[model samples]
Target: MAPTTPRPPTMRDVARTAGVSTATVSRYVNGLQRFTEATEARLREAIDQLGFTVDPVARSMITGRTHTVAVVILDIRNPHFTGIVKGANRKAQQLGYNLLFVDTGERQSAEAGMLRELSRRVDGLIVSSRMPDADLSTLRDLDKPVVFFGRASQVGVHSVSADGRSAAAMLGRHLIDLGHRRIAYLGYGAARWDAERKAGLTDALREAGLEPMFFSADSPTLEAGEKSVGEVLMGSARPDAVVCYNDMLALGFMKQAQAAGVRVPEQVSVAGFDDIPFARFSTPTLTTVDMQSEAMGELALERLIELIDGTLDASEEMLKPRLVLRQSTAAKVRT
Candidate 1:
């Protein structure tokens, strides 16, 4: 004779054992309605005895809210992205939501796959994408509330970003005023945000009746910055000052400069973007732009909540950038 398996518990079994209507049990369990203390005690006792647990899939089906969000970042290793993720996670938890983060490793092709998979499991999305407008448009069409963290799109997606063009122009003007004419721009290939900063620098150079020597790094990395320094120093027009894409690149160039016995600010003044934490503590502290990345992340999460609740109206927000003066940059030395 084979032993029969024990019958699995159900909501009905809980309601029957507790001597309450199924509707009352359902409402009380889901927190949509309350019952008398006596009824609640009976239900809890029944649930304990039956070992009943609410299945998340069933709960989601009933409430129509997964209470989960997906955030896609370009590079998780970057401190700038770390700040954004921290802000977003804090804000999301306060709003009764959990975050699932994905790193694209700066790969454009990976974005589509991440979106396809995560969109099915999360209630909303927050992305700091480096993809083109055409490729990013697919995300807006996913029928899920989405908020862009850094870049804005023409597809009318909600976004939070810094005015990098103006910030870069300000940095460029500062260098120009400090008597730096033969300036070189060190950065990776074309990104809209990068393009904006480059345009600002180019316009500033044009206004000063000067031209820039452009050096393209393979990627936004310390190694790229180190390798690009050789190109900048060996070029026909040696730059008196250099503007790097971000702090890592700036530090890399500074490292190479030190090894080559080139004095910072004295021989080749250096500047960078994204005033990360170590920027202020680095040897000859890095002069860079503060993009308020954490605030951007918090704002994006707030906007995403509004979107989920159907209260959002504006499609975009632009945060301000500030220039931080540090020891890495100074008036060019006359040599």
Candidate 2:
């Protein structure tokens, strides 16, 4: 005959051991009522002795809250997104909540499906979406509190994001101060921040009585940056400086340019956004903008929780970006 499994300790066992009624024990366990010190002590002792643990499923059924929050990001492989997750997860654990993460692989359809499914299981959501405004507007019907990350807020949704335009303008002014004229922008067309950053750079250049040259990368990856070296660095009227969409592209561009016997910050200066960890450790230490990725994540989670609790109305929070100076950029030498 198969061995019988021992039954797990239940509230009845705890109540019996503590010499209390089952309803009293339930109220104590759920923090729904206060008891005398002696009674509370006895209940605690009984719980400890019996190794009693609250059943999450049962508690959730009673409270209508799963104590779980979901975070949806575009790409898990990117350190920026991972940093956001790390911040949110840390805060969730501290608040006695659980976190569920989903990587949409930069696909709008996948993002939508995951949001719909997760809304049913989690208390709230945090999304870093790349979808158009029309598609994102429909998320209000999910009936769950949502906080947008790294994107603009919709009509009724809260959002947290770094000021990309101001940050890019700061970078542009820095390069201009370093005497870098004939600047080119290497960017991915699909990024939502692309237009903002580009406009900021253009604003700074126009202030200096100059216009920027534009180049496109198929994607915002290291390989795309490396591949653009020929057209951006070696072609006729080669730019004296190039501002990439992010750190990965800048690192790749620097690597390829150096391999082709070009000097960084000497022949052509390079800069990037999103001051990722690898940016400071790379050869010539990349100059970039610090978007406060982790802090944004933490704030987004907090805002979502407040929304869930009905303590906060839909709003937008914009984080300030700082410019990080490094050896990758310098005063342009006159030919």
Candidate 3:
């Protein structure tokens, strides 16, 4: 009898062809293992010849849970989001959850796209913006768990945020206490946050028979801050003290004030929020508010897990912000 041609190859056959153990072949075939390009190509060739197919039922049995938490943020450049991620990471590792971060870069379309697919792949989600409220509501309506970070809205499935209103309020009160009657607020975020903080400032100012000059901006980036301050300093009316959205913007404003030959805390004092890592080292040793970023992150994760496991109802909690005084603000210089 002529030699029989080889019978159709099996997983074992492919494993042998690829010179790897059966376990390695199984991992590669299931996309559970990561290997070098060369090894993956060889495995692909072996599988192609063997005509291997993964059992759907068996795959499901191996992965009991989706094992992923999707973190969606607008601008990763913002440290506020970073703090939240750190908190999520800590809690996720403790619970054996994998974190998958996506930077929407503040794009509404991308935020929408990510939501549609992420709902399918992740066990839960932590979103950081407001535009996807309707999509998130649908997910909640369908029993999917999602939490919003930083910004707050009633429609979010679950929301996590610091007491930003109170934080800004604290800053506002500090300025008022310093006897800064002609104050300016360099603000960012939605009208809601701005309004709340400004309300706090207004409340305090109204008590003191004063009002704040407010400037609204698209964001708290350094350039935006620089321009905002430059314009004010050049104008006929200028604030004696300026409170900024974040440390970066605050730093920019301070730089601009000095460039215009204004003495900080003498001609005009500047302050910022978030007290980012570099805040203390800045030239004037910035006075600012602490949003408790890491704590915010840790709390968010703790809350998200509870919500996902049906242990906690959706709720909103605020963290109290603290004021760190340095060389930035002092008794108003004698005019």
> Which structure among the candidates has the greatest lDDT?
2
Give RMSD to native, each candidate.
4.9, 2.9, 8.8
Q: Which stretches of candidate 1 lie over 4 Å from their true place?
A: 1-58, 150-153
Clashing pairs in 2: none
Alpha-carbon deviation at 238 in model 3, angstroms: 1.2
Listed in order, each prediction's TM-score against the native is 0.83, 0.89, 0.77
Put down candidate 2 lDDT per residue, 247-332, tens digits, no spaces: 88899999999999999989989999988899989999999999998888888888888988789988778999999999999999
* TM-score ranking, best first: 2, 1, 3
Candidate 2 achieves a global lDDT of 0.88
Q: Please write out the lDDT profile of model 3 over residues 1-335, one tens digit for every residue.
A: 89999766667888898888888887776556788888888888888877876665565466434667787776678776677788789888997677888888767666565687777777678877656334555545434677776444466566766666677667777877787878888877652355566676667677778788888667667777777766667678888888887777888888878887988888887888777877788778889888787787777777777776779877777788888888888767655
- Model 1 residue pairs with clashes: none
Worst 10 residues of 3 by lDDT: 133-142
Residue 20, model 3: Cα distance from true site in angstroms = 31
> 192, model 3: CA deviation in Å?
5.6
- lDDT (CA) for every model shown? 0.84, 0.88, 0.74
Q: lDDT value for candidate 1? A: 0.84
Quote model 1's TM-score.
0.83
